[model samples]
Target: MKTHLTILLTLSSILTFSQNIKIPSDTMVVTTHTTTVKGANINYTASTGTQPVWDKKGIPIASLFYTYYERNNVKNRAERPLIISFNGGPGSASVWMHIAYTGPKVLNIDKEGYPVQPYGVKNNPNSILDIADIVYVNPVNTGYSRMIPNKEGELPKRETFFGINADIKYLAAWINTFVTRKSRWESPKYIIGESYGGTRVMGLANELQNNQWMYLNGVILVSPADYKLYNTSQPVYSALNLPYFTAAAWYQNALPKVLQEKDLLDILPESEQYAINTLMPALAKGGFISAEEKETVANKMAFYSGLSKKVILQNNLDVPTSFFWKELLRDKSGYTIGRLDSRYLGIDKREAGSSPDFNAELTSWMHSFTPAINFYIRTHLNFKTDIKYNMFGDVHPWDNRNNNTRDDLRQAMAQNPYLKVLVQSGYFDGATTYFGAKYTMWQIDPSGKMRERFSFKGYRSGHMMYLRQDDLVAANDDLRAFIKNSLSNGKPAKYEKD
Candidate 1:
């Protein structure tokens, strides 16, 4: 009888512990720390916590894990700027920008941004935290965030949190709750998103304004992924990639000696002009173009892309980026260039394949990022949870339909005079070429009425430009300037004819 009682008690204790590990809908763990940013000693409070996502009945349906950093001893918190940051992947945690970009601490990587051993974080000297309080938010299923089951053990429908529109809707609601809870309604606000996050924040800018009734002063897109041009085989899509190809080729020293001798910046304008004026029109002509024009375009593409004319002709002048990655160094070297950041190279089992076996840059990043985030969240932030930290979660079957996010940003800017946009992209980012980002920016406000309010900055590195030391400092400085310049300074929010 005694043995049976002990066994039952042990089983009950295990069940209770398991239930506790399901992640509380609303909970917080706060820790205080001091760090120097840009030679300024700063003290800040890190609030690592989970905020509940409620259903229509106001019942908790999910929990979003976030780390919010606010500088301590602010004279008036209402006047300070608050930067809400998110990384992309639709299913990616906010880890990339959290530690590597604008956060107070950064990954312990080398100056060039390659991962170093002893994977941990160090104080980011160039963190924008000195100018603004920042919050890194992980959407549902990413990081420690997860959906909750009801008393009947029924999970919320995946449709609520996995689609483009669905993501914007819930996150906007959550932001409203967060701002209200923290009493930051009067604060100047900016939303920055990277990659797929670019698509997200574009939709969010409008969603927050119309639905949540919350407005932002600025929107920052970091290597933004505009889906319209991503997988589409349109002439614009194929042509826009030419400039990026030129950049990657230049970096690899694969371009002709004439182009290579000229500085990268000097040669890029030629490539851009060719892409817009020559290549786009030529590609649009398709096979109808005289064979002479096809050959002419092929020769120019070879000159710009560092690929032979034969290969360019083989693709019929619409050279897929995958083929470029595979063929760029096929003769010179057997290495395959990375898809996201061409600076990184990988060894493939066979060199004759059309696409790389894997994304070399992503794999290299995961090696350092995965362990650092897991360690930082648990140890530094002191948020204790046995839940597995998902770098990339399973939020798939993602509904990407009705993507009016690009236009949504335009509308948001139109509605709010104080709203401004700053687009930053890396020259060598093949996945979402810098030129494509430029095209997206231009298309956002077709009227060009809001052109002055929009700005673009390009870095020499890849998608996560901040990973490179020089770009990190420059990028944060750019953010500081953008925030400061976008502030209303008590001026009324209205268009003025100067």
Candidate 2:
């Protein structure tokens, strides 16, 4: 599922690939190395900070290729703070972070998130740079980053992503170089990670605290995954997914009732409570129910799940994901929509015959980002590379299993008594669903008081809700408030921007 979220549909051929970028003679292509007991492998390049990229639209960006943006130039005016940010795909570029949150160029998203003109970047007056210097890193094989030539296929995919300990061991070595070279040892540090990066940050905090002897100031998790629920190990995962199904159904009006209510927070809890308290037991009964009785329950379930009764009962209440994709619109040429982003519902009405849902439906949009991002990078940020940026490179093969690092959570807070957090979720996001983050946080910070150290807000948008103008403004203001309150009293800031 994550692979699909990050995959690019190469078949579309929407844009032709440009030739390798020429490395200038005067420009030195530098390499840095870090060694782990696992092996000495990370590859990196650096540039002394330079120019502007763009004003946040499709407009031309003006930074020299390979130059780093020296956020420290304009000191915090008090103390120095360094915050590292990255998006999780394990394969996604930090573009979302750069363009949407910290970059000089920002898209003017609409209230409903339909893009409009004057589509340019903003100065990000609310940026944390007012409080800290932010550095965005693209993980290996994603964005303009790629595995060094010899190291390209040297390591198997599994070795790179599996075994939480292995991952942290390798990642820390790489990240340390960036921090060390920039002479940020004296600066208070923080990390911001989204999705898998969120999950990864926990372990990273542990390593940074214990191994690197660096205690972090704080960590931010946006739409994170707590593998305990996200992984396939739990049979109850199917059970938990039901509420999200209802949440999705409610938002899309897949439920029998129009559910005209505008906000998901208003509806999801009720439906979620119903699923846990009643519906789950009914579905668990399985063959005990008579055909007629089964049909009745199925209809009700469908009503709640935004699916059809016949389709619901067909698979013994284990209706496949594809059913949700196409069943809703079976009456409309079998049109199916994205489970991740419902924005671009596609036409795939033909019979899928109980087979897996078509994967390509969601890949196109993410793929579209590749060319667009490349164009912007080349034309604006003069930093160029010969490497083929893998928008969704499967650097590691997932076993479709779960190994949660929720315990690593407190190690972060414990290490840095000063750390505070804000977690944001999109009601419609299927990738790292809201409840999943809740479940993990509940376990991690069981004492509601410490848990209160974090504030979780819901958005009407999906995984990338920041793209929507309303959400973007809300997020900017909310983050600004967080920094403001944190700086003022060293307390967690609270804001509800649903």
lDDT of 1 at 135: 92
Best by the lDDT measure: 1
Which consecutive 10 residues in model 2 have the weakest lDDT in total? 1-10
The alpha-carbon root-mean-square deviation between model 1 and the true structure, to one decimal in Å, is 5.9
Using all chains and alpha carbons, the TM-scores for the candidates as numbered come to 0.96, 0.74
How many clashes show up per model?
0, 16
Looking at candidate 1, the ten consecutive residues that score lowest on lDDT are: 1-10
Q: Which stretches of candidate 2 lie over 4 Å from their true place?
A: 1-80, 107-131, 149-164, 261-263, 279-300, 349-361, 398-404, 447-449, 487-498
lDDT of 1 by residue, 1-498 (tens): 001110001111111114466556677777788889889889888888788888998988888889999998999999999999999998999999999999988999987788898999999999998989999999999998888877777778999999999999999999999999899999999999999999999999999999999999999999999976675657546999999999999999999999999988999999999999999999888879899999999999999999999988988888888888888998898888888899989888998888889888999999999999998987788777788889999899999888999999999999999999999999989998899999999999999999999999999899998889999999999999999999999999988787
Candidate 2, number of clashes: 16
Model 1 pairs in collision: none
Score each candidate by Cα lDDT: 0.89, 0.55
Q: Which ranges in model 1 have alpha carbons more than 4 Å from their true place?
A: 1-20
